[model samples]
Target: MSDWTPAEMPRLDDATVVVTGANSGLGYEGTREFARRGATVVMACRSVERAETAAAELRESTSATLELDVRECDLASLDSVETFADGLAADYDGVDVLCNNAGVMAIPRGETEDGFETQFGVNHLGHFALTGRLFPLLVAADGIDGDARVVTQSSGAHETGEMDFSDLNWERSYGKWKAYGRSKLANLLFAYELQRRLDAADDDLGVRSVACHPGYADTNLQLRTAAESGNPLLKLGMRAANAVLGQDAATGAEPMLYAATADVDGGAYVEPGGLMNMRGHPTVGRSNDASYDRDDARRLWEYSTEATSVEFPL
Candidate 1:
């Protein structure tokens, strides 16, 4: 990790940062830190009530010198994703940073509202569609101190995943962790591809896509998954890991915070700088070798466009 801490983060007095899943965990931590640095924050979440409560708590704890708006957005629903995009476009000409941080972890097999496998749909397609819908505004926005960024949250699990397009929805078989890995891998591929397209676009657009991972954070994400998975052994194992190996959510949020706010190139992957990357400070990182496959990324992009029906204006 770099020597950069939240205290050294750049001020964003005129910036707007949109964070999905802002109701809890790293999303909430990122929102709080961004707001603390004077950025107008849009807390996009699945539940409005939870979002409102989180916003209130954020306000109470942090001395924000800017604004915060909590908007409802269910990533599993295409309608909700479009609605959230429409609302943001109507309210703001553009936003400085878009943090695609909302996602599902290892959980029981399920389907999204649009019938996509739960993990692939919410973790990959949801953000893909959201970014496509919001691209115009992203291209229009002036990055607070550098270039506008679409910071997608990826994970270490991606190292073990591959783009099984034939089984993209995991219809024939399923493993929660494998599904989770596939989604994270897709996240990296999408970020890299988006950055490639932006790099080829008009320089005036001043937009780029980057990615990061939170490392092993003891957030409700895992606990929730285990509880809902109906597997006592899985639940117990996860609980044990949380108690012994997990870092606090705030520490885990550092890499993402750095990736979103620091002056960095598109396609860069930020991760925790410590032993096995489980806990440490923010640092410039790299994804697995598979994540760098241009052909895979392009194919995934095309398929995602077809899947989500939201095309980028590149």
Candidate 2:
């Protein structure tokens, strides 16, 4: 498949886009690009101050004819996700694009504010709850617009993951990277299953679920995870690696932007088109066989719904 570049993206003037974890890194860069293309950009971030600062920077730099709204939402907490969804539903009649972009990686095993494993809670369940709660607004947007898109961020590390239902929370043994891999794998499975449900229901809600990965981009998430693990050597190595092969966060955002706006089929998984999925341009990539298992996807969907207590109308 041919790779996609930021310059090739379609004009997003009429789209109302929400990007979770929009304070920095790929999320912030994605927000900037959408705003630059004239989409009303909502920065849903855990840090209100940081999000506001980033929004202000975008406003100062771009002459794009779109407004930016920064809202606070901590994906690690279901209550916070609910509040954010509630506020969005109350304030806006519709949302055209929902980008589940914020995520944590390789952090020390720990609990969230809600006492769930941090990786699963924030990376999968949180977005699951948020998307479920916001489905109505998404449908509303589809009623007005021709299409509405939901983009979930997965990772290449998903290839190394296997879901352990018996120890989903890493209760028996918590390995930082493994848990993170499981969470990311869950992301791809969720996207695939969601699209399948939408198709089966023949829903014309104009909502399609897609997944993308920002292949080895230089982002603050890596630094934060390394700091949490107290691994200076790993951090140093990552920094050096990034300096050599990592692309800018703007480049990293290309796959997501393409998935959200490009004329692509539903259920496509996008990633950077470079050597070994490191960094470059955006293209449709292959998902692991495990990620495409219908049985596993359904089981995970059921488990996630039970865990997050958010019911989908499917």
- The most accurate candidate by lDDT is 1
Which runs of model 2 end up more than 4 angstroms from their true locations? Answer: 1-3, 143-145
TM-score of each: 0.97, 0.96
In candidate 2, what residue range of length 10 has the lowest lDDT sum? 139-148
- The list of candidate 1 runs beyond 4 A from truth reads none
Give the whole-model CA lDDT for all candidates, comma-separated. 0.90, 0.88
The alpha-carbon RMSD values of the candidates against the true structure, listed in the order shown, are 1.3, 1.5
lDDT of 2 at 124: 91
lDDT of 2 by residue, 1-314 (tens): 45577787777777789999998999999998888888888899999999998888888887665479999999999999999999999899899999999999999888988878999989999999999999988888952237789999998889888998888889889888899899999999999999999898855667888899988888888889878878799889888877887788888888898888887778999888887876778888888899999999999999989888899888
Error of 2 at 68 (Å): 0.8
Name the top TM-score candidate.
1
